[model samples]
Target: MTTCATELLDKLASRRAIVAVIGLGYVGLPLIRAVAESGLTAIGIDTDPTKIEMLKAGRNYLKHTGGEWIAPLVEAGRLRPTGDFATLAEADVIVICVPTPLTRHMQPDLSYVEATARSIAPHLAPGRLVVLESTTWPGTTTEVLKPILETSGLSCGRDFFVAFSPERADPGNAEYDATGRIPKVIGGDGAEAREAACAFYGLFVERIVPVENAATAEAVKLFENIFRSVNIALVNELKVVYRAMGIDIWQVIEAAKTKPFGFMPFYPGPGLGGHCIPIDPYYLSWKAKEFDVRSQFVELAGEINSAMPRWVVDRLAEALDRSAGTGLSRAHVLVVGIAYKKNVDDTRESPALRLIELLESRGARTSFHDPWAPVIPPTREHAALGGRRSVPLDPATIADYDAVLIVTDHDNVDWSALAEARLVVDTRNRAEREGLAGPRLVKL
Candidate 1:
């Protein structure tokens, strides 16, 4: 092992290493909490002053991450939040958890990651470990980050250790926590870097999966999300085909899931959503083009998934016309649960935004109700949908709408109350499962 790798491993083993986690958003906050909870000193660095203030005050901004967990850690002096980049020099281990969003043309935009890399490169010293937890295309660690870090005039695996470890954060998941519930996948350029990366994460993470190289580790994250995207696209395509044949896709899925083997259930939705599913596959597809290979599955899945909002709007308009003799124009439609998934406030790439826009363009007046997200926040893609607040749900409110569209199946919604709608278009199969059967109810 190299001198830097050996020193990092020794510091990690003795719990003497100070872990600096950049970006105090969804991914970084939980990781900082985990490191602190593991009895290790963690300093959270972010450019957002509001987030830094919230963390310093021992409060939590994310609904899934409780303030009770953070208060004790802050009080014990194990966790510190700051907006200064100068503190980067004090950390023995630096973890980048910034966002990697796609550009307007649906290309990989690594501005946040690149900016963070440039900022910290000046502070990187010998024996320090830098691990990137941001999701990106393969070769990002070597091609993009390594060169930026080498600006410090130090050799990477020799002067300092570097690795790629994708963050597997599923917000609002009750069964999984960032600390140890999810196995961490780590990789680096050489054996010393890989071993040092694994050993560092082994301190707080319960399971460490060391892959062949950094590129493989990056590909693993994209592959996992692409698998979901493709499978969901398959079910979504089937939902349309089954609907035209006067068959219920939800019942078919329920039956197919009964098979003990060879079948894993993936349900259809209004469209693909969340930070990963709707976005990550494009990164892989974009990367594949460099090798002169076309990723047909990814392209087809994206096409199918992207068309779902229009399909759902078309179905809703037809349902309205059939049930109430009203076209989409001037129709009062209420959207239930605007969040990407159940019980989470995160709305990145949420299908509900597209559904609302499509409905509005068709002259349908749309309103939404999400218990978690009281108001639609500004998004990188759907800035026009911002400032809209969630409408209250009740029997009277349900009866007023021409149709109630169930986009996200949040558990707290009163299904019984929703059953009273004039016409209900259930995209998530929420009504049928609740035993609400009638011509007034429609499923996609």
Candidate 2:
């Protein structure tokens, strides 16, 4: 091993390394806690002062990451949150876990990742290891990140080490914690960088799978989400096809899943949501164009997934016409769960926002109810719907709506109260499973 690689591995073995995590949002915060839990000092660096203040105040801003998880680390002084990049010099290992959202034109936006690299480049020193945990297109670590860090007049794999490790974090999943149980996929520019990174992550992560190079690690992350997007799109297309044939897609999925060995079920919903599934696949599609190749499967998936909100609204309008003897114009529609998926407060890329806009554009009066998100916060894409708050889910309130649309199936909702609605458009198949069935309950 090289001198720099040897030094980092020694520090990791001794649990005396100062691990710095950049971009302390959903990915970084939990990682910091894991680093602290491994008996190393963890410093969380972010440009957002509001998040730093919240961390200092012992308050958790994310619904899935509880303050209790951070409290013990803060009290023990093992974890420190800061808005300063100069502290990068004190860190023996730095992990980048920033957001990689798509641009307005559906292209890859690496601005945040590039800016983070620039911020840390000046403070980077010899014998330190840097690992990127952000999901991005292939060749990002070696192409985009290496050049920036080399600006510090040090050589990677010699003076410093670099690696790419894609994060597999699932928000609001109680079954998975940062206890090293989830397998981590890592790759580096060279053998030394790869060994050093694997050793560092081995401190907290239980299982580490080492690949050939940084691009492979990057591809691993993209492929994982792309698989989900493609399967979801397939099921979504089948949903429309089955609907035209007078078939219920939910019932079809349940029956197909009975094969047990060959079938894994993917359900159709209002649309894709959250930070990963909806946006990460586009990063691959955009990158493929550089090689003069088209990602046709990914493109088709994007087209079908993106069009789901409109299709849902069309079904809803048809349901309204059939049951309530009215059109979408001026119809009172109650939307359940504004967050992307069930049981989480994250609303980024949530289909419910699009569904709401589509409904309102057709002259439907829309109101939403989510136990997690009481008030819709400002988002970059859906600023107009920011100020709206969740409505009460009582029997009397539900009965007032012309139709109730199930967008997200949060577990805490009073499922029985939905039985009182004049018309119910079920997109999640939740109402039927909950014993809500009648001429009024319409499954999309």
Global lDDT of each model? Answer: 0.90, 0.91
Question: Which one is best on lDDT?
Answer: 2
Write model 2 residue lDDT over 1-444, tens digit each, in one string.
787778888888998899999988878888888898889999999889999988887788887777787777888898899998999999999999998988899888999989999998999988998999999999999999999989989998899988999988887788896547789999999998999899899988989999999999999999999999999999999999999999999989989999969789999999999899999998998999999999999989999999999999999999888986878997999999998998888888899999999999999999999998889889778889998999899997788899999999999888889878899898899999899998999898
Clashing pairs in 1: none
Report the lDDT tens digits of candidate 1 across residue range 1-444.
Answer: 777777788888899889999998888888888888887899999999988898888788888777888777888889988888999898999999998888999999999999999999999999888889889999999999999999999998789878899998888888895667799999987788888889888888889999999999999999988899999999999999998899988889999999999999999999998888898899999999999999999999999999999999999999999998989997999999899999888888899999999999989999998998889998767889998999889986689899899999898887888767899999998888888889998888
How good is model 1 by TM-score?
0.98
Output the worst ten-in-a-row residue range by lDDT, candidate 1.
Answer: 172-181
Runs with alpha carbons beyond 4 Å of true place in candidate 1: none
Q: What is the C-alpha RMSD, rounded to one decimal, of candidate 1?
A: 1.1
In model 2, which regions exceed 4 Å deviation?
none
Q: After superposition, how far is residue 56 of candidate 2 from its true place, in Å?
A: 1.0
Residue 291's lDDT within candidate 1 is 99
